[model samples]
Structures are given as structure tokens and as C-alpha cells.
Target: MKKSLITSLAAVLLLSATAATAQQKSMGGMQDMPMGKPATGQSVHMARGKVTKVDAGANLVTLAHEPVKSLNWPAMTMGFQVKDKMLLDKLTVGRMVDFEFAQAGKGYAITGVK
Candidate 1:
């Protein structure tokens, strides 16, 4: 009876360990993929913010933006990409403007500005 009890306990412990390892592998798989990138032709999210910095050379504009409700993003400062260099000309440091952006990859790309 003691031997049977020991074997049963060991089996339970092995199952628990297997479950834990499977959970860890699933979690790691999630991290390996990018989750937030928007689909192609997704609707742009409009947001208003000040142009904190503009890097015309890099075709990037940095903005301190208000909460983006459509994307569930909170107010924060981050750089965005512009497909056309001329778009950066419309932005200036400390100037407020409304812009539309969609996730292009791991980052956002400006689709329109006003």
C-alpha cells in the first residue's frame, strides 16, 4: 500500500511539472510574436498633440499626444514615421496639430495631419 501511494504521488507531481512547463512554453510563444500591429488598410486613429521634436532627416516626427481612444493608448510622447518627408515640414516643436496614424509595423506611421 505504501509503495502504491508513493507512486501515485509521484505521478501527480510529474503531471504538475508537465503542466507548468507547457504553460511556460505558451507564454514564451506569445512574447515571440508582435500583437499590436494594425492590419493593412486599418482605420487611422486621430489624435492631437504638440510636436515635441521633428527629425526630417530620418522622416520621423516626435509628438506628445493626448490619449488615443481608438487604439486604447494613453497620453505619451513617442516618435512616428511619415512616408513622405514633406509631411515633417508641417510640424514644428511645441506646435499643436491633429494627426491621423495607423500601426505600420512595430511603430506607427502618420497617414494624415491637419
Candidate 2:
């Protein structure tokens, strides 16, 4: 009876760990994967924010302004890697603009800005 109880407890513990891992996956862990509309079963759209900083060499920019549903970020600062060099010139810090980006597996890259 003791052995059976131990086995049952172990099984419950394993299941709990798996559930926690899954929750973290959807939330944001270290290097959390990008969230997509298709994966969520709803048409996801590009989130827009104001440019705070830009690094051409790194092809990255720091944005702060509003919330982004795509990445599940609230009105806060966030960093995004640029997909195209042309986007560098288009970014204007402290200016509001409409934009869209594509997920490059691990990080994200801006594809459109207007």
C-alpha cells in the first residue's frame, strides 16, 4: 500500500511539473517564443509602439509607448530586432507610427512601418 501511494504521488508531481512548464511556455520565460494569432486560434495582428532607441549595427531598436498584443507586453519598454535596414531610417524616436513585424523564430523583425 505504501508503494502504491508513493507511485501515485510521483505521478501527480510529474503532471504538475508538466502543467507548470506549459503555462510558462505561453507566458514569458527566458527567450520565450513569439506569440502568433494562428497559434492562439485567432487572427493576430502587428503591435505598434513608439521608437525609443535604435541601433543600426545590431539591427535592433528599443520601443516604449504602448501595449503589444502580439508579444503580450503592456505599455512598457521593449526591444525588437529589425528585419530590414530600410526600417532604420523610418524610425523616429518619440513619434507615434503604425508598424508591423514578423517573428523570426526566436526574436522579431519589423517588416512594415507607415
- Which is the leading candidate under TM-score? 1
lDDT of 2 by residue, 1-114 (tens): 967865555454345434434543677553424444443243334666888766675676666646665545456555666777988888867867677765554444566677
Candidate 1: regions farther than 4 A off: 1-40
Model 2, position 110: C-alpha lDDT score: 68
lDDT for model 2, on a 0 to 1 scale? 0.60
- Candidate 1 lDDT by residue in tens digits, 17-54: 35533554564533222223444646667889999766
Model 2 clash pairs are: none
Clashing pairs in 1: none
lDDT of each: 0.67, 0.60
List candidate 2 segments past 4 Å from native.
1-44
